[model samples]
Target: MSEEPSARGEVLIVTGMSGAGRTTAANALEDHGWYVVDNLPPQMLRPLLELAGRVGSELPRVAAVVDVRGGDLLAELPATAQQLRDANNLRILFLDASDDALVRRFEQVRRPHPLQSAGTILDGIREERRQLQSIREGSDIVVDTTGLNIHQLASRTAELFEEEGAPRHRTTILSFGFKYGLPADADLVADMRFLPNPFWRDDLRALTGESEAVSNYVLAQEGATEFLDAYVQAVTPIIEGYQRENKSHSTIAIGCTGGKHRSVAMSLALAALLERIPGLRVRVRHRDLGRE
Candidate 1:
């Protein structure tokens, strides 16, 4: 899945909670052929994009790490990002984590959180979360790193930005389990529990949704095909609207009791249907497939 890089420069704003693996993400992007700039001020984003545009494919994909390190200047990022979106391919990837995870990381490193000052690390995290609320909302993707190690985070980052020459409207169909909690980054969600569970079938219990037997069982259900057809129909217009609005990415989460069977099968089926929509790039991922 590769093609010539787009002529127009693509810019990614890498931000979010400090110590949430921003540096690791930047390293992964760099290793995978993205030009990465770290600790970049918010105001420099426009100029950087302009430079990439001038250089064309030589600088086709560039990622900038922008965060609270800029102090008061970080306030201008949203407006600057909006201004760059009209003529450029821009996306924001926010890396976030739970307060406890952040505190642990800070303590392990024997360093104070940037905003901690004389207060506790938790205090700094609370303040940072409040300050970043708006930017996080506007971000195209929010990766919660609460349960991920550096290696896992790096792999996840690669899964997202490594693909080359993606369509104008790209979507990730993620299959997850309800018990593990919902994905923080889901733009839309679909529940698959209404259909029969493949886990109940004695023969299918050992197999995953990737197997033909389970996929057939799930898709052969009474309303499965109809639901897939209608859901794809319902989502087409939204993808078009994203194109019109210069938003390049979206995520649709499909869930069931555990993510191993029904949700995975349905997510694959849905991706197959969506692939026919022309100009839309579809990728499927089972988030909780092997979890216990």
Candidate 2:
């Protein structure tokens, strides 16, 4: 069946091991524009998703944190997710870290474990891990944050939901050598260095891809058509797979030897190609595009 216009928004179910940064991630998702609900019961998941779908269409994004705190009812989550899928698109992200990290976080916070009320932190960690194994395995994305600080985690989370500029939902960052031109970061990367160097194209020299003249000159190249054909072939399937999985964001990087000219042109082209995908968000950045 054709996907409903993405239902106008998304529901992200956030769960994972204790002390694995679910709270932090939820906060970051909120910063990136997601409306968040924390520590809701698993039994209420179906009803909540339905309500969110009814209301979230106006909000654009929603996230919830579910974990062992649900007590015995936590086991019912997987089934609840399956049931919700018939009416709404859902993505589950399970966050995890090393046992040592979990223990360290607990000690740092000096809070009693919900499951460890009767035992050591180690015991609590083990039980939580055992109980969560199934959910973790079923997760669409598993983020291991053992070494990531709050900033790094926030950056990663923001990358998933940021909706401006290049393709926001599914981006590919491709790196390549200038001599070989741009790598297949998207469906196409046009090399403009061989063109009447925009850097030397009269009044247009200082303009980057953001300008109409530079864009026109790059698109006017003979190789542009050939590259676009090959690019679309290579990029179409990757994006299709991401869409099938209901991904919210992707980053594809295109790199040339100096990160200028060719890579920039191709990156812009790839961003354009991605725009054709329904509801797919795209974003592009040329890491070395301005470097001398």
Candidate 3:
């Protein structure tokens, strides 16, 4: 979808270090509306592409996860990918991370590396790196997940495949409470706790932000409008830059003490203002609206 709409669909091969977040990248691609096939052998590339070719637009963007598990079949990837490069809109996305990061991830999951083979995790990583040298060099995109957490990795994956010139940038303005754990995926966080808690008001205690009265009350708070305006101004350029870099989605979390009233109202207000930014698609979602 990053290119013009055509009869042909795009094929992406997602591969690289085992603990380097290949699954996470595939999940991100799936969220971005791509059809993802995990742990595919290189030999199946032809059949899959052929199937997609027949299906046409229905299976437009396909991402296949390939890895060292293919054994000797792994050798076929370079040739196969090159053969389909021009005709199939083929791309290779290599996910990678530092050896230390990969080792830590494997340890946390209590799983040994696939190539460990009577050796340490570092040994498996080193062997995989050697095996993947040529493949990595041939890849169209190489993302290092060393510095990125899961959410950021997902955001990067979405951006990698976002179509040029499309209104692809999306912002989910989320409302939550501070008591619940922080949203691990949020890109921007705003605290609406400064506003008066509608939960404390007798008349509005049971009312939610969707109600006209609660929304008005929250928005009517002294600095509410100013904060909304300032936040909108601050994020406008950031969203614009994301588009320029092909980043497709962002989450802005608005939190109040209880999330039922203040955060939800501020979220709606921010969504309305953010929608005015030309390239952004805005939606408001309350994550902790009823979790009192």
Judging by lDDT against the true structure, name the best candidate. Answer: 1
Report the Cα lDDT for candidate 1: 0.88
Q: Among these predicted structures, which one has the highest TM-score?
A: 3
**Cα TM-score per model:** 0.55, 0.54, 0.61
Is candidate 1 or 2 superior in lDDT?
Answer: 1
Q: Roughly what TM-score does model 1 have, to 2 decimal places?
A: 0.55
lDDT of residue 192 for candidate 1: 95
Ranking by TM-score: 3, 1, 2
Residue-level lDDT tens digits of model 1 in 107-144: 99999899989999999999999888889999999999
What is the C-alpha lDDT profile of model 2 across 67-174, one tens digit per residue?
998898889888877766666768899999998999999999999777887899988999988998888888888999999887667667766655565332456544
Candidate 1 positional error at 78, Å: 0.9
- Where model 1 places Cα greater than 4 Å from the true spot, the runs are 1-7, 165-292
Better by TM-score, candidate 3 or 1: 3
TM-score of 3: 0.61
Record all residue pairs in model 1 with backbone atoms less than 3 Å apart, i.e. clashing: none
- Cα lDDT, all candidates: 0.88, 0.71, 0.86
